[model samples]
Target: MTTDSLDLFADQPPTPPAPPDDAGAEAGDDGTLALDRYAERAYLAYAMSVVKSRALPQVEDGLKPVQRRILYAMSEMRLSSSAKHVKSARVVGDVIGKYHPHGDSSVYDAMVRVAQDFSLRYPLVDGQGNFGSRDGDSAAAMRYTECRLTPIAELLLAEIDRGTVDFIPNYDGAFEEPQLMPARLPFVLLNGASGIAVGMATEIPPHNMREVAEATCHLIRHPDAGLDDILAMLPAPDFPGGGQLISSPEAIRDAYASGRGSLRLRARWRIEELARAQWRVIVEELPHGV
Candidate 1:
């Protein structure tokens, strides 16, 4: 015999097995399954939960679950535009202890971001302390900060008092929170959103309220308007911070049409002529979310 014949299977296991009988088929019918199936189902559940309830913002209000909860908690405290700013710690505490149940730091961070003028195109919270910096500095401790809702924020919460949206019990069932804000406008497109979830991601740029309104009005008037026509009305993003969009109008239109592509933006600056022939370049507006 050759040396290959001495192999374990070669020595005694050359016979072909018969096809699976009825009993063999029945064996797989039990609740047990391949390990991958169990893992797949478990992972799907987690992904869906993250995508729907945590990561992505709701299209109707343009707010993520945490953001919505923060706003709801602030509204409950009557932190309206006309009201006094409450301590950031109190808001974080209430959010963690009630609706969010995540952690104080995260909740405070979200609130701080909402209050930051350099962050949100339309700031929701009006802060009264060292919230943060544009150069990537961290905000002060929550205890040192105070905040209340801005006038624009009131638009999202106005109808809540009138029962425009239904309230569901908080995490512990001790309180109630709105299912979704009854937004008077398309805040999602107005503010924009970016998030990464399991198997998916989204990054939408902010737009000027007036441009958005004009496009929206056109759509309302001519319901059959195509994406190109809409682009004609609002050619490119109008950052509130006022930057130059380097991307051509055609590129912007393509992005909007295909629901993908990047819009290049450059900060706008102006040269100031001073006395004695001295000149200084001053940055006027930065591309928001850059």
Candidate 2:
């Protein structure tokens, strides 16, 4: 056939396929085939998204993106050191508007966690206003709250920001993330952690900063020391909120040995009679997440 004739046939448009009669398709007798394989793939993809993006820590940066953004935003705001305190709302707005792109609530929650003394043995932020108390009360509204970076935060976050730690692009490639918190102290041990993932979880208790530092120093001195030696040096969780760790001695030993366990914490409170027949109950210390 001639090239022109062949071209006419090749260029001919095929008829469009008929659309499905109903939005819902027929299901198999077992109702398995009706399930969208793509849906399962999509669900798994979304779960991994949460796990990778929100739940788990990336090897590159010891902190998740929210934490990275908080530190970075605090750095940019100059709230680290030698700067006036900024409103918690302002910090929250800045974090949400600039880096996190998540809900303001999540950002604020992270900010509050960093500021709360009971949460971190060495609080990263020096917070003002009703950043709540050790008595398990909710903090004042973001509008009513104020905060500034603490000296410890300055030491850990600011010192490291000055070209000490590596920075990477955030999830959207819009902001930078720290490779790791260049904390002078072993913050993870000092503050401890509690998180839940898909199939795994972590629950650690707070330790005294000074004591943990001493233990770390001891470990550095004696690299070959066993867990017993470390536990002997750093016994029990000395929470900032001053609550007693209710774990038995053996339980404490097992926790220190395996580096995991449930820790029962209580708030330390004292009562005083105020003038005019009023009683004032003051909480001196609290457990983590109180």
Candidate 3:
């Protein structure tokens, strides 16, 4: 009975070969890494990519990678203010082919948002067709649209050729791209930013240009001045699509100081009196990101 059972076992397949050793472990006997360590490294890499390459705008330039790439590609095409608008599809194609190396829709969406007046305090692109609406309507397809850089955008790219900023290799390394725009103004604070990265997110509200300039000059003059001095000049955020700030001045100061706080924004409306007894509330502006 033992011999028959042993023969049956021999006919069965030999235990599958032990799983191959990991590349690092096989390449160097002493280089073996635990599974947890490997997972930590991988996750850290993904988080860095999301934070640096995809989500956050460079504070200096106020432009995300995709937004910057689209503008750069358009500049390459000589789609400046004076130049006639070109099919948005052409710009999207150039971006995806040359630098971005992503889906066409993503590039186009980024471009569209840059052109939106209600979105940016100062729009970067001048689009010739239905870019979108504040009512939450989607823009027309890229093929049906045309665009060129606005005058303000030219300011960002003005000294790009003169090497005002560093250059980095593109996704495929076939070409190079700017690390950030050579912005003449502090567009980062001017335009504001909102992004969600791996561990951190940002939500900066747009500000009035005049107030921003004054505050900047004030800082230049009084480097040791406290937040009150800045707040005296800047007061509170002034969004492009004007809205009323219900947050008190003290609360605003606290938010700016602590790097975390929410602003209470109310829609700006006006009363249009049709008659002595009848009136209508006309909403002139909506809260940011409404």
Best by TM-score: 3
> For model 3, how does the per-residue alpha-carbon lDDT over 58-146 read when each residue is reduced to its tens digit?
88888998899999999999999999999999999999998977778779888999999899999999999999998899999999999
Q: By descending TM-score, how would the candidates be arranged?
A: 3, 1, 2
RMSD of 3: 13.1
Error of 2 at 38 (Å): 8.1
Show model 2 residue runs off by greater than 4 Å: 1-49, 56-64, 134-136, 264-290
Question: Ranking under lDDT, best-scoring first?
Answer: 3, 1, 2
Candidate 1: minimum summed lDDT over ten consecutive residues — where? 1-10
Quote model 1's TM-score: 0.86
Model 1 scores a C-alpha lDDT of 0.78
Cα TM-score per model? 0.86, 0.71, 0.86
lDDT winner: 3
The lDDT of each candidate is 0.78, 0.67, 0.82
Clashes per candidate (backbone, < 3 Å):
0, 2, 0
lDDT of 1 by residue, 1-290 (tens): 00111112111122232332332343356734565655665566656666677767888899988899999888888888899888999989988888987757668878888888877789899999999888788899988889999999988888787879888998789988888999988888888877766666777777788888889899899999998787777777665567788988778877887778887888888999999999999997787665
User: Would you give me the overall lDDT of model 3?
Assistant: 0.82
